[model samples]
Target: FRFFRWVWRVTYLTTFGVLGFTAYSIWEARNPADQLEVDQSKKTLVILGTGWGSVSLLKNLDTENYNVIVISPRNYFLFTPLLPSCTTGTIEHRSIMEPIRNILRHKKRAVRFYEAEATKIDYEKKIIYAKDDSDVKGDTMETEVPFDMLVVGVGAENATFGIPGVREHACFLKEVGDAQKIRKQIMDCVETATFKDQSQDEIKRLLHMVVVGGGPTGVEFAGELQDFFQEDLLKWVPQIKDDFHVTLVEALPNVLPMFSKQLIDYTESSFKEEHIEIRTKTMVKNVTDKFIEAEISKPDGTKAIEKIPYGLLVWATGNALRPVVKDLMSQISAQKNARRGLEVNEYLVVNGTENIWAVGDCAVANYAPTAQVAAQEGAFLARLFNTMAKTDAIETEMRELSAKQSSAKAEERTAILNEITERQKQLRRVKQIGPFQYSHQGSLAYIGAEKAVADVSWFSGNIASGGTMTYLFWKSAYLSMCFSTRNRVLVAFDWLKAKFFGRDVSRE
Candidate 1:
């Protein structure tokens, strides 16, 4: 009886403690403390884009050091890892997005943000030309913003490889809008196939979903689609189940090139069990509204042209250079040989420009353009900028002390000299920051049927895992990495909502 009573008491206390802490966290996030005004006398530091790299930098940076201004067409930082789930309504789009204004409000100093696209970057003039391309037109649509220091994190766009009709027909899976479109298209295809007097041939075409690429995005989306088909679509609309099918077309020999070979084999086998067809060694040559033209390589090395019809097509090949990034590269003579993205030095500084630095997918740093790489790069830059600011402050203080020593008494002069010496040592230590170094964490990708694969760095070596346990680990890792307490809570609720109530099947 005594032990049971103690257990109940402990549980009661723990429940209240958690509730109290959660309430406080919510209150604090909603009500930010006073912020210091932006001082124009300080160096103007400008950041572009609200993606992983830029957001990570802002979160770690001491905003009080500089007059900071951020410009991006997007006003929110998107957690892109779970973007595939959005396509099937497993996760809501807004749950993974944290508003830029909310993030800036919690900073120590005031930060300026503009919902405008950076049209042109003038390196010589140290100016960025921005234009507001939102729905509503403002009186002053375009303006020039000058900065003493700039960080480019605008990221990249989808690569089509000059395929005909791809841009017009295929849906991408990058942004929130893309996911919404895919979700709507899935429902549209289902409803259209179930229409009265719909021919069996047309039903088969409308129920077939095609995904191009073997990367994480394509694999994850395919998994989510299969889950939807099994869990919801078949139960809700039975007639189309017989005709429904999904095919993944990859130009590579196999999918998920980033994972271990064992895990790759596991994924392929898992997709087979889920009845998702994988067409490897197949190159898509053309795309139309209803079908795609592909060249399939035979076992004997010959190729055969085939037309694969698809109701909904998703293209997720890889990233490509944005026009803004390309224009900036063209202006720099040193970037003439660069093709993929901007060439950066060891410190991630753009070549041929001292004041400009780049991170994320836009910068060529001999690393894969994953969110992990971008976040790490952003944190490195934050530390670098903070050290630079400290160095400048130390130099200024030394100058003032030296001037004061000249007019001080003999006794005061000794103390002033001692302080100056200490300041000099501090300056040396602050300026000794090392070059940017990337640390590779592992990779994770979700397959269908509540299973995921992980290639994690453990101790001194690697550990590859694939199954239900890895799926739980994946969810926890992503949840803990959310931008704020609010985002994490919302994502948790979204997952539970989908599990208990099933994802909303309504077309949006």
Candidate 2:
């Protein structure tokens, strides 16, 4: 009987030994800790744009986890929120732009940057064809890059529609080049009109400025132009001071459709006070070198056609899909319905492809193409990638232990298996950003000087604030949103200087 009991004990020990060994082996086979090791295998993340969205991603991403590359024609990210101020020299253009290279210096790993425009994206083979301005003029210096992940943050282009002569004569305020052109044109017209030989009608035409589309951009530009005339032109160039005029034309009945009714009234009242003409319900039908033809909706519901001669016409219309994004959509069958931009799923992944992801204005994220949206989306993606890396590590460790179970002791084997299971739960715990939900922080528009409007959240509900206190809040909020502390301090100083003296009149 004693001999039988000894045999049973041996059998029981051996069976459990095999069970533990089997568990370890199976875990190791599946886990492949090395294979699962966060794909640190030189996976390339291609970011396209130096705008707020792409820049925000670059700032937040885990650089050590991937080979990061940024592609954009511009080498710096322009702070566009304060761009209107640049037109009047309230802030130097250079002050609002931070170099892309300087921004990337904060990355854990050096990022590859391309100062070229992406011409085509071959998703079938995962390649991006690009060309620089020098190479775009039928040159043979085009380049191609292969990427594991491609982020399309190319933003949008200015919409000219199909209005005749509009593209040729109207000035757009979408880019830095546009602003510079407008400034130079403004000066050129003023100088030429003030010529001793210029006629009265010609001088009036040269000084007359018409701004189309009363959106935030148009309103802001008009305000800046008025401020320029009131402060600088009136004092510096008094020859054509009486002849100068500024007109804002909007198709909508209200100046600011996005603002509250009270704010809109305030803006209109302010414009009226400044003698700046506000033409609402006015649709520009055609634009000529010296005049603009528009159909005005009258109180009697009749459309009256009128022509207004002007020296400068600024078009601040909204954006349209860029050519690159349009081409990409045509090339991919799954993206056929994506007319606005590349359609993305909840994961920010391209609808058809699993490996590819897109962010920012180029992607149809079901959210407003605002800087705030893109920045948050990019940060979310970075956090997701980081979690993926951790999961891979856990899985790899489990697989490795399973494969070497025969060599590990029973206690060590059991402990390793428990750890792997626990890691799996942690991986599951990582939050995934489903279809994005935008939280409205608030909307603020700078009119001029210390006048602004803001619709912000209050303790009870949303509050519409305007005037001096609102202007102070607007400045503080934008300052805090600046990319760095240095930027915040510089912007603050610029405002102080502008208040104490006046805006600089020098144009670079």
Highest-scoring model, lDDT: 1
Pairs clashing within candidate 1: none
For each candidate, what TM-score against the reference? 0.97, 0.87
Best by TM-score: 1
lDDT of each: 0.94, 0.81
Where is the poorest 10-residue window by lDDT in model 2?
A: 31-40
What's the CA error at residue 29 for candidate 2, in Å?
Answer: 47
Question: What digit string (tens of lDDT, one per residue) describes model 1 on residues 366-399?
Answer: 9999999999999999999999999899999999
* lDDT against true structure, model 1: 0.94
